[model samples]
Target: MSINRQIVLASRPQGEPSADNFRLVESPLAPPEQLADGQVLVRHHFLSLDPYMRGRMSEGKSYAQPQPLNEVMIGGTVGEVIASRHPQYAVGDKVVGMGGWQEYAVVNAAQPGLLRKVDTTHIPLSAYLGAVGMPGVTAWYGLMKICEPRAGGTISVSAASGAVGSAVGQLAKSRGCRVVGFAGGPDKCRYVVEELGFDACIDYRQHATLDSLQAALREAAPQGIDGHFENVGGMVLDAVLLQMNAFGRIAVCGMIAGYNGEPIPLRHPQMILTSRLRVEGFIVSEHMEVWPEALKELGTLVATGRLKYRESVAQGLASAPEAFIGLLKGRNFGKQLVKLI
Candidate 1:
């Protein structure tokens, strides 16, 4: 029997999750005496920590189901196939899928959302969980399919230094769009503008007001924002709404500001009608059909050094909860990953 440590939801969080909400427990893993036809045992390597996990802590109807108390926390991870009863996946294959917060997982090879083997030599294995994975695909399809940015158009992206936002800004820049980014601090803002090639970057935390944001937007995008990649919804969304040009496109990727359970108030709902702005919310999973193509493109960009990515890696599963809370607080600089040896 093998023993594995896993992080489970100990209690439902009232607002922002504290350390008390999670509990790490060790369980003895006994292999099935009779092998299931298509089951495989996986050993997790890198676990993804996303902002969406915050919503899963609360009991409510969301895009994804909430995690029940005492259940292993849900997350995407890159793992290696340790044992396989399935013909499709053999032992020693590196795969990516939803393995939750555990050292080992039993998965069906033919399952709808089972692990998919990837070529890690072309790119780092962790990139599969970030850029070449969900966040990358989210930025790609969200901008192309949802926002439909035109060449030479001006676009604004919030959380500009983050995984998804960074991809959005860089992709827009490569497409000849004037890309403006909104980040928390001066360092992040500088990184976005200098490293990511953004036309301008606003330090939202420094300015801290709608008027200041609008003024910055006017300075960055004098013609007005033709497209906006809305990562942070609350006040930033409200401010961007006022600066949007006619028939502007808005891809609502995430609402990190409101993820802590605070009610986010919208100052202007009429901007949608007046500017004929197209605002749409989407989940990256919804565009699974084009995963192969998106990965190919993003991987090429990363290989050629046109696209860059960063990760805030927390060492060990014990640090996952703290890393998760830090992610919600915007303390992480890029894609947050929990490294498990």
Candidate 2:
């Protein structure tokens, strides 16, 4: 039997998650000959660490149930199929799925929408967990379906250098919209503007107060924001609300500002009513029908060198906890991944 190293949630987080909240354990994997019908075993190469996992960690009433304690932490993974009993998958097939924080996973491949084989000829296999995967579809859904940004309109993105936000900015730019991004530090802001091709990017660190942030947005988006993709809530949302044009569309994705149990009260709630703004919240997982369409466009953009993204990979399964904590605190740049090998 081959031993598999995995990370499990040791306890519910009090505020921000720490190293103590997670535990590492080993489990024995059955050999390929023992696999049941329709089963496939995958050896994960990279594990995706995202903000939504924080919500799943809590026992609160959210869209999904809390992650069971002492169980493998929930996450997206990209890996190769080491063994397969399913007709659709082969032993050497590269796959992407919700394999959690484990080195290997045996999944029932026959289950619909559970596992997907990806082509790494042009797009890297690791990208299946980020730009060409869930985050990319999320950006497409919120920007195209909800915001409905028109050419020449201005679009604003918070947490702009992150996986979803970075994709959102690029997609908005491709649609001929003026893209403005908000990131934590100068380096991320510079990358958003210079590399990610956003029209302008504001470093939220420089503008601590809501007034200052809104003033910066006013200068960056003089035409007024027609649509906004919100990742971080609280002050950032409030600031964007202040500069929004009439009838602007706001897509609420993640409220990472309050992920640590802190309050994220919006300073300006009246803007929605006065400006006739349309604010809608969504969970990308609930909309599986759009995955094919979204992935097609995102894949082309990535393969052709039009859509650009970055990653901050932590080495080994032992590094997952610390890397995840850093991700929640906005410490990691681009997409945060654990290189499990």
Candidate 2: worst-modelled 10 consecutive residues by lDDT: 207-216
List model 1 lDDT by residue over 1-341, tens digit each: 38889999999988888999999999988675445889888889999999888988988878988898898999999988888888988888899999999998888878777778888776888998998888999999988887787888999999999999999988888888999889999989989988889999988887778888778878888889999998888878887899999999999989888787788888998999999989999998877887888889999998777799889999999999999999888999989999997
- Count: clashes, candidate 1: 0
* Model 2 spans with C-alpha error above 4 angstroms: none
User: Each model's TM-score, in the order given?
Assistant: 0.97, 0.99
Off by over 4 Å in 1: 32-34
The candidate maximizing lDDT is 2
**Tens digits of lDDT, candidate 2, 132-216:** 9999999999999889989999999999999999999999999999999999999999999999999999999998788898899
